[model samples]
Target: MDAIEKNLLKEVAELDSLPVGAYNIRANGQLAGRNTTANIDIVTKTDKPGIDIYIRPFTKNESVHIPVILSQTGLKDLVYNDFHIGEGADVTIIAGCGIHNCGGGNAEHDGIHTFWLAKNAKLRYVEKHYGEGDGRGKQIMNPTTIVHLAEGAEMEMETTQIAGVDDTIRKTGGDLAEGASLVVKEKIMTTGDQHAVTDFNVDLNGEGCSANIVSRSVAKDESKQEFISHINGNCACAGHSECDAIIMDHASVIASPALTANSVDASLIHEAAIGKIAGEQLIKLMTLGLTEKEAEDQIVNGFLK
Candidate 1:
């Protein structure tokens, strides 16, 4: 990997070197590196631009890293990756994309990831998106994720958009069976004239199933952000969605949450809060030898953390 690609990997996945266990690195729309363990397999698709990962049953304490980097000008890349986790397995997946465009044309990457979890399986997935360059070209990314959980399966997802993407749209959907659970937490920050939108749709389709989705964001300068979530409970289940954001310096944010309960025993709730930083917060921080901007940044960092 080149220096640019390595830097991108660090920023997106925090990998300073080749990681142990199963891993795949994609750079400039091509596979840069790959490794697979005995219990985990990674195979490239013959008909499309993507890979499929399979984990053996009863696997535990394993991880996979699949990070994508785009450092070319005027490049448009799209990929579809799918993961099949076996029964009674527990593992972690780290995936993300970073773009460094240095030309006068737009550079964009769109990725679609689907996950299937078998009965009694558990998965922890983390994904981050970042963009940077001193160029007139725009950096754009759109990611779509779909998840299916079997009986007693569980999944926890953490997604973050760190900085510098000019435009982004994120979509996540899930379906849960009996006794299954899904939890999604997202964080995003947009500045300048960037625009960001997130959409989440989840269905709790069996008894005792549950889904929780939460998002925290900061919109600065002329950036605009929108958060939309819809959760449906088809049986005796629980669902909750929350969106919290801080608006600053002509920025705008909108949050819309909807829930549908088809069974009498289903429980659903939604919450949203959008506001600016409190003056008292800045005053308190400033009294401790910090500038106004420093105080604001500190507060924002702590809030996002």
Candidate 2:
């Protein structure tokens, strides 16, 4: 492996040795690697960052993980991942993108993911984005996700963006059928002069369908972040969305959460709040012999965790 790939693998996957049933894709110019189980298949189209993943039916209690890394500097990469989860399946998906740039030009990664869950299926999807380097170039990431849930299907998606990304725009949407449910939790921490904008939308189109979304973020230094979430209930359904953020230094943030109900049996609600660390919490920790910096770190850790 080259030095850039090595750095990306270490910083992103946080492992020298890969785990069982793990699929790794190093997206420099095209789709370049793969390894997987019999129940799950991975295919890459002709020299593109687009990948198709198929999970066989009745593959209950199984888990699949795919980690994508971009180690090329002074370039732009567009990746599209399609996932098809079969009926009666219970699965957990761990997928994320990490980038390392060491050049002067711009380094950007745009990820587009679509998920299709069959009837009675349950899925827990987790994705985290991170970028790091000493280069003068900017590291920007744009992630777009769309999910479709069949009857009686349930999907819980969690997305996180750690430190070091310069700019990001995150967008996610969900469409739910009868007896279907979708839950999303997004966490982000931005430093320096980074900027992030996120938008989430959900349409509850079936009876007994439900959708819930929550966002947590911490902005430090001169960073700025904005979060917009909306949930629409077209049938007898329930929807909720909330945004919570911590603002530090000269950073700024905006949280806009809205919900609408068109059906008589629908119930929708939303809330948003932005604040900083309470001085009392820090003083309480200081009384336990921790320094101010240590106490601050502890609080950040707890909030993010």
Candidate 3:
């Protein structure tokens, strides 16, 4: 595979050939992408930071990709993707951003995505961010997402960030209406001197609305990571938020989970935890004939999975 293809696979392994409605964005510019099925009126414009995805009611699923890379120093890019889902639709979306910077300057990608889920719709959205380089260049990404769920709508979102992101800040905001639900699962890994911050704010705005937010991360070396999560119940609803992290070396981590209930019937809760690699667990794995590094690797892989 070519460098672009290899880099694409590193973040999205389930994709082989480009799927329908695939929007490919590179460091140089945007590519003439594919057209999806007729059920969904998907459009790609040449002048935008990213693509606009429109889904008709009951339209099929969509898969999208945005990969940015630089072999030299001092490159920056910003991407924005907007999604409009019609009422009573059920769809799954696979989307992510990747970067490969091998130069001496800084390479950055700021992705701003907004989603509107119509009434009674169900959406499964997954995204991953990654960075890799052989040079001393810095890799940075800032992702801001806004979600609006209509009455009785439901959205399940999963986001992951792999290694090599030198600096990153993630922010997500969500609003839910009557009988609507939102679930978010976020995972991250940081090594070396990398720094990362993740924050989420969500509001259950209508009767019977609910939300659950979970975040997990691992920091190694002098890397630092922070997780901030908040959920608000404005009506008679149920909600919960949790944050967990593992620290190693001189790494530092902070977990902050908060929940607010404004209505008399609103039930909300939050929990957070931070810890280091257990020595006894490492010793037990070593007794199985594995080295320290190998044991640590196994533990990390499992935890992230």
User: Considering every candidate listed, which one attains the maximal TM-score?
Assistant: 1
The digit string of per-residue lDDT tens for model 3 on 1-305 reads 36664555556534555554644545444443445555565566578767777778866455444444343347677777788888988887776666677667887878788999999988888888877777488888898999999999999999998777899999999999999999999999999999999999998898999999888889999999999888888889999988888888999998877788788899998888789889999999999999999999999888889
Alpha-carbon shift of residue 166 in model 2 (angstroms): 0.7
Candidate 1, clashing residue pairs?
none
Q: Which 10-residue window in model 1 sums to the lowest lDDT?
A: 129-138
lDDT of 3: 0.80
Candidate number achieving the greatest lDDT relative to the actual structure: 1
The best-first sequence of candidates by lDDT reads 1, 2, 3
Residues 173-218, candidate 2, lDDT per residue (tens digit)? 8899999999898899999999999999889998999988988899
User: For model 1, what is the alpha-carbon lDDT of residue 259?
Assistant: 94
Q: In model 3, where is the ten-residue run with the lowest total lDDT? A: 63-72
Model 1 Cα displacement at 266 (Å)?
0.9
lDDT of each: 0.95, 0.85, 0.80
Q: What is candidate 1's local distance difference test score?
A: 0.95
Candidate 1: list runs displaced more than 4 Å. none
Q: 222, model 2: CA deviation in Å?
A: 0.7
